[model samples]
Target: MARPVTNAAFEALLHAAGYGNAHAAFARQLNHAGRNYGTWRYDAASVYWWLRGRRPAEHVQATMAETLARKLGRSVAVLELGFGAGEGTGTSIYPASAGQAIDAAERLWTTLAKHIRPPVSGTFDSGKALQAALGWRYDLPDKTVSRNGRQPVTTGDIQSLYALADHFTDLDRRHGGGSPHTRALMADFLVRQVALMLRGNYTDVVGRDLLRAAATLSGQLAFMSYDAGDHATAQHHTTVALRLAKAADDRLHGAHLLANLAAQAVHLGHARDAARLAEAAIDGAGRAPAAVLARLYTTAATAYGQSGERRACQVALAKAERALDRTGLSVGPRWVNYFGPAHLAGAALRCLGDLHLYTQALRHAPDAITLSSQNARTRALHTALIATIHARAGDTDAACDWGRKLARHAVGVHSARVEQRVRELTAMLSPQQALPQVSEVLYALSTVPAAT
Candidate 1:
């Protein structure tokens, strides 16, 4: 085993923040700042352990930095405190500014392009995620986005970027982002092509358009990372995308990115964080198109459902329904064109399923499956969800039937999300393995390889 190295930088920051050599004071401050997250019990001993080279939990690190930043009257990033990789180094979940966000995205793409795995702390920071959402909700738009670089960006270049984004989105929906080869290709494209375009010269008008397009691409990459079960990368990319959207003054896209983060939070079992993020997205979505509003509302419903707030979930679902009813009144952005009745139904299914209203959830499954037929990953997820609902409802035969369908749809798909649903379904049915139908479904699922 390697010897633990003391965190000299942390010690320096501790002193600079006026705690000096007093670990007890810093511990008290940390506990006070941590109250908003949850009840945290920290003492001088905890601080001593950190000083002795033991890393604290992710949320605790965030709270420590936040407390120090308050005392020092300046931003103190966790990386600066010698806890982990900071936003400047490209491992922090969110960057501090639009410029830093772009740089972080570039660094990440370049690293991935070289087949190097970026550093992941393997822990989700709910506090940091919530902070990013709040920032997106309240931050002022960038005054100007004009830049002078090696080449002049043109309207044609922006259009090509949009087209490339569409291409990648389609590919992700069809084959999922679980394949290492596909993810590498995307990183290479961003590094070799998109990075230069972002750095190229342009007017504010053109730059805003470029930023919006880039945000779309980055958001797609974020979703792809989520589908592949790389939560840290997904969170980083989502934060970068949120910054790009803000710089472009695109509140609608920013709201969408927040919703994505909310979904990721729900997946990671951070229901309260997910609820707060979804609420922020909805609150910041001013005068958005009906489709966008519907998506946001549905996302909130899912979060609320997971948090066990049935009334709030129902209200959100109703709002989603109202928005869908008015969707024909206006045109939404091309990026959100995927939202429709089927998408709404799928969201409702997940929300209701989480609430254990299995019958209501099952009502939406057919439409979700049929409408999402072209997207193998979506179909697989819905199928597994339906199967799980059936199993949970004590319908073994029906569950096995849906399980067989999931097995069919899940083959050749590279999606951790899909695999997760399958695992859930199998676990739900595992008790009835003696039954022939259950045994058959289990055997079929066994043939599917684990997602990369």
Candidate 2:
């Protein structure tokens, strides 16, 4: 008999989950995850199977992975655990060849639209994403546009996809992520319409454009999910978007997504993760437009500020300012169209606010107010920020003034992030809620749930 080496992986996972013994605990987890193999004993009998190098059934692999995922608070892919080919309806292959990448994307799209059980991919690790972004910039696989599909694709189809992405971006900007009706429509359009066109035959040039468009749309959905306060779902889609960018050899697009993911990480209090992601974006940008560079630096500044690194944060913010000055409102990419001085000013407001530079925050805050005027969704955030700044400065009246504005602007908005910020502001101004406007606004904000 081969002497048993310690099953470090399984044992460590079990220990990390606070399980004392593997035999009974593994069985319990299986039962808890509703995985039963028709009288296949899960106790001691199956405990050594994994250690003995036996491949588990596909469904069992999924159940065990998911059970561990719930405990770890991250999506876990069964394949990563050395399980045999999983039975997941969706493919999670981040493809090496363009044709394979397209096929993989279709598989994921169909399965996600169907809402199959067991997630297709693992949680988004900043390290992995950073590597992927760098890989895209340096070493993307050679491409081929297969002309074997039944339907033929054209430049018009690519343009239509771009327009569709733009439409969703506009909708998200106008309505925030809380517009379930619109978000649902966008999701369906992506799977039913976008995926269909993506699968059709097209020339290499047209195919690259189509994939880039799809990446942008996926990133849009990720941002929407972030706005709605669904971080996990946001991460899930963002990973796919990054893969699409790689597939299209779109380094700038990948960089953009890296920044977006960084911002989300910052909001979620993963300051170090946010910083790394921002750095990845900057590194992969490859002489991108000034606006894109500025936006990336601003994101980095926010991360460093959140991490309590004042000097680092200041440096990043200055870099952003320099990039913005170099551009001087020169039009940038359509995706980064919002990264002007005013937008950077808004980002500076957030960064300074995080650093407790209340005065500085107040100074930059007004520049962003114009953006709020153009985008109510952004207004919700600005109002919340300005209100907090005033409250922190002991200006209760001014805070309440902005609070009322927030409440007014938030009437039709459904964003969890904006509402969360409002709630934080409300808590800060709780002592002053006796004022008529404060009372009214407090009552209005009462309906926003703490959850997304």
Candidate 3:
């Protein structure tokens, strides 16, 4: 076989960036910048391979580009370093200017509108997510968001957008985000309507409100994509939302977006990243409403639990509980109204279950189920959690019973996250498939179609 072709462009960029023959120093900078993602012990030998045309991982490529940008004191696209285009490194998570941020958002929205499915790499950039969180907390808000465009944006227009967001959010909560039709409709709205509004003329005050409304809709789309198991799309939308929130000077909304990213990190098994993101959200949530604080705390608890920090998890859960108690007669943001008693109980159950504290987890299961009666998706997820808990405890009968309940509750739900839980429960029961109940549940699970 012929030898791999050397990446001349990468070498040229490295030389231009002053690395030239100092592969060791380049590797050191890459490793240091990579700490946000995880430990990277790359040395000269590792950089040598890249010089010989060995491509780095996507996240590593991003890190390398960022490192070069810092050294050169200029923006550097990943493709400029010989990496493939459209790999999510073209746009920075924290753009240097508001114009760049808008340009990034426009590009992402346009790409998403075209329904471009990114290659499924099954990779989560915890480092990028963490960076976005840090930027949101420390970066200065835009001085003014006033814009002049062809058509003028009005208060009525902003109100209409908020109403539409509420409608889409309700659809997502009820029917789940796995529906192709629902996803298409949301994308259509974002492109055909929201995009136009963003470019329309508006004053500073109106522009701030418009950005907030757009951020809310974008965040909902992010969660929906996440539920559909399209993590790349989710992250893209989340970045846009965070940018909008920052431009609007909405710190609480920014905190909510960070919490959502933390939840995604936890789902993707980056427990440490999840914990850091959640902690960032909590720290930046200054004077937030009680409901919002509770939501952030619960996210931290789940992340800590996943990391096996039992004491930290418990502390977060207790803080969540106290925040909820303080939410007694006050109405928080509509986006956070979902984090009431039922949601908190479900989070506690999942956190305890992550620690293998089945007995403690079970105690919260009833409240999770009963209180989430109207939320089919949450109920289905909690059902699967209960079944898994029993399966882990070696109670085949109890597990199978809850498994059947999960099947029932999952009938109309279209959530990839819930379906994943169902698959896990089935796997646990597969070992006991010799039993009639386990076999029956397994058969029931077989009929459940993959969430779209």
Candidate 4:
């Protein structure tokens, strides 16, 4: 017999799924959803009870819809399902159709995977997004638990690709970069798998569906190579992402992939190509989610900055802001939730700062600090950027204060990029060495611990 679900059990499941902070985020959303996320809220405990097979409070029947909708990247009117926000003693508002239920479950798992951090401890990162993403499509945990039956997809190759991604992510973290061979292997596997699935027993629904996933995985693998400075491999993987996106009829993913290509071009010093690609991405991003549109615009701004088009950069930044404004009224897709208003401002500010638009960049600095999360790497990077602006503005004491925080937070992380930024700022202080704050920054720099 299936074990009875309890509040603790469900909470434990969420923790195992890398949603340990979900309740807190849930509570915050409940308390301030209208002002923050532009939606209604739910009681976490009551929702837990509802999921455990007991009827929810009469007023909270829509809680499932609200929770699931947030996970699925859209607004929902779940309360209209014959109850209010806390009506525990009623019939389910969930669809009676199995197909409908499957779709909902898939969306929920996919969204959950995107938001949760991949497990990176032990042999590998536990609760990895890639794994979770794959599991959502191929493995049905709820079905296994609720139905006492197991069903596996026929595509072994796609499963292998997900496993490969997990291994690759771990290696990348430990070795500082993935090998070109591994990246290529993963891309080839995905492309081949997608091709096979397209031609196999799966109908258009399943084939296109699988292709969309394969393409996303391939794109990410290719991005890995790009980050490792393997531009050629990155190009190959990006092409796969584009092809897969088209196959899946997902214009948004394609646009974002193009932006990734543009970023790689800029990194490779092909500024003209970068700007052109970014513009294309922005133009095509019309059908994408709001967060995606904002991300594309930010990429365009970066490309413009690299090509030294001050006016173009400013225009792109404005477009980016507009994209963010759009999201203020609608929830973002799971993959794009991390690219919130704070991210938008931080990215735009960083690009402007990079282009020496110090005054313009300062305008967005406080937003970046306020909007950014508590993650160590992000905090370190944002603080460093903020301090860089302060240093440039001749605010030595303020610069040092933020800079010290950056250095201290960066300690014990495996990121080289953050350290490089710190070194660059330290060099920038040479002109202000006479200032006590400059000396203090220098001392702090000397004490920065090496990445473990």
Candidate 5:
């Protein structure tokens, strides 16, 4: 009964609206709707059954919708309340209003928090993603239209969120995504604090600030989710982030999110999507600082490289390098402050690595490692790349030697992505597994706890 479509989304709404338990709320809702169901004395168990994919008689579905609508203070379409058919392709999340958007995000968070697999994000051609990315520039209706609420939100409240962004992002940079608890802490912070404040009263200007803060947290959660190999969860979070970015009218951060998504697409082997997303990022970026522009082109190069479009890849790489050349004198937002020549070197090394240009990767990957001292997780990845190139070169000894270093770094870091790099290195050295140096590294790798 629990395996089929559990009514998690409906349950989440019930909880989010503070009904406490399904038993009382479900029965009360039914009674309110005059649904006595003939001889049935509807109890919480029946409510539980209904949530477990049992169809409530037609009239009860309407009552449930109305109950939720009243609690949420918005008209609730049955489908929008997440009572829609459980699974299929082409589940669209582009909501028509802020309330709906928030509900969508809430449902997404609830699903992910419970470790349920979200439905696949409908696929898009390069054209559609490009349009979506570029469309963020167009003026849209304000998303934070709720000016009336119980508490009066202040600029100081918004500032605290910004401070939390800085704090949590630094933790991500230093520690990696090894600990789900830490990521959960960030999510809980959003749900408990940011989500609550979104329901509070604020002026238009303050509301924009509030949304921007939420957008930043959404991006952080998405990045960490991807780092932990939870791509589906990450996609849902990124979608919310993109929507928040658009709603806040934050073009620079919006471009940052799209560029990051492009890099992610390249990693997930969707090169065409990456290229289009990168292009879209640039299209609407509106004179961003050079570092931000460099990131966009760098990710575009990565996409092209993975697709075996050598000439196009080189062109993008050149543009990326040139953008870095101009980055020294510019100042951008903190979100993009991590980008520079080191970041470019890492991206370029990755492009070459994806293409299996081992010799070329070795040449620049070391420099990338050298330049990434500020970021521990990335340094570990770059180090692993160098080892991978060595492994490919048949320098089993050197590969094992460098592999040891990466494992050492991985052991200290709290990142599954870095450990995955260690795993990749282990795979590359698998042929020489019997060798002492390689065996030693493998034993070291064995000691680092695996991510669940």
Candidate 6:
């Protein structure tokens, strides 16, 4: 490979990530910190990949330009390093014609059929060097590295992939969160697609971008499995997501995956495990915008409460508030735009209600309910919380009235968590009241699981 000459491309990436002179700045930071300087040094091979649009590890890339900006007392974009447009001397990874997109997809799938899956093994600690390169690390090794027997990857398959992933996302949103059937389909599909992407040939830059997109999709699929109560399937999808995120070297996606896993852990009653995963997500998100940080920390607090760590839970909640403040200070990423003050307040309020801090929970409840979007599941959850609060206050009439409403709204909705909340409210109804409200709620509860 030639010396990294894609200064223009690198600079563009830096600009997209909101950095200037990232590489030089990173080097200076290393020197100032008396850390390993080589990590900051980009080689010809790395530069070649970068020029083609390949990204270094996420933190490194951001830090690289930020590093130079600090030292220079001014800013320069990472993409401005040294890049030029293709000279029109080689095959096009992007199809030149509309027909080529389809041709490329088939060729990609076919070419990917020949590679073997990576062998599964016990967990291993990737050393500091690799961790730094990957832009993530943990004190403990809690993940398994295994192969799911997928096909090889090939050039031109990205368009097909884009189509397929998009279709699945729509289906998921339409049919309900990842149901068991959907989760199974997703795992099988991902195993095949991911295998091909791993083995297929592509320019480093193209591959990195594709992997990043794929990772996000895979993580969502994993979440579907968790929603369906298929923990093993969810874990497998999560592991794949982590691998793809690493290949893309995008920490934001990785952080999201970890957060998903933590949510799964909490659902499974492994609160401590969930807390650890949440902490890892926060570490990965590093300096993410306020909206994103708020989302992450809110999740952390939820997990902390699950683990019975009251102090830890409040501390994380406080952090979430601080992160939300940053949204006013800086523009947030698109993926996190859905996270706003209302979203945070709602979730925090619900958590408080769950923890039985009724007054404080009530304090945030009205605001959260008011701010809630058209998210049916979230609305259902809030309704359940209101029911729970009424029950706790010994208002049998109000409790049963709200409980019936929650149960009816939850019907035909494919959410176990929602069902559980409905059950919780039903359980709290006072048999002594014998009110018609109580009977209506009890009738609804008869059809749902008793434990939930």
lDDT of each: 0.82, 0.72, 0.82, 0.56, 0.71, 0.57
Ranking by lDDT: 1, 3, 2, 5, 6, 4
lDDT of 4 by residue, 325-364 (tens): 8987766644466576667677767778768888888888
| lDDT-superior candidate, 2 or 3 | 3
Candidate 2 regions with alpha-carbon error over 4 angstroms: 1-104, 111-131, 134-139, 145-147, 328-331, 372-374, 434-437, 447-452
List model 2 lDDT by residue over 29-145, tens digit each: 786664222223577667666765676654455567778878888876655565444432233223455555454444444333434343444444566555555555566455555
Please write out the lDDT profile of model 5 over residues 1-452, one tens digit for every residue.
35553777877777767764656766766675543222225677777776677765323454566777787798755554455544211242444455545555555554444333343443423343444465565647574454676668899998898889888878777777666787777775675567667767888788777878888988888888777776656665676677777777788888888887787777678898888888878887868888888888888898988888878888998988888888878987778877767677877777887787777767786568765454877877777777877887788888888877777766556666677777878888777778787789888877765653
Ranking by TM-score: 1, 3, 5, 2, 6, 4
TM-score of 6: 0.61
Q: Every model's Cα RMSD, please?
A: 12.4, 9.9, 12.1, 19.9, 8.6, 20.0
Give the per-residue lDDT digits (tens) of candidate 3, residues 20-120: 88999999999988664435799988877887777776546666878898988897766677745543443336665555555556555544554543333
**Model 6, total clashes:** 30
Candidate 2 lands at a TM-score of 0.75
Better of 2 and 4 by lDDT: 2
- Measured with C-alpha atoms, the lDDT of residue 50 in candidate 5 is 67
lDDT of 6 by residue, 185-227 (tens): 5544554455345434555666666666666666676565455
**Per-residue lDDT of model 1, residues 1-452, tens digit only:** 53453888998998898886788988988888766433468888888778887876444565687799999999866567787653444354556566776777776765555554444455556787788887887776788889987679998989998998999888888888898778778877886677777878899999999989888988998899899998887887888899889888899999999999999999888998899999899889888899999999999998998989999999999999999899899999999898877777888888898899989988998787776545777778778888888899999999999999888888888899988888898899898899888999999998775778
> Which of the two, 3 or 5, has more TM-score?
3
Q: What is the clash count of model 1? A: 0
- The residue-level lDDT of candidate 2 at 418 comes to 88
In model 4, which regions exceed 4 Å deviation? 1-201, 228-232, 267-269, 328-332, 371-376, 430-440, 443-452
Candidate 1 RMSD to the correct structure? 12.4
TM-score of each: 0.80, 0.75, 0.79, 0.55, 0.77, 0.61
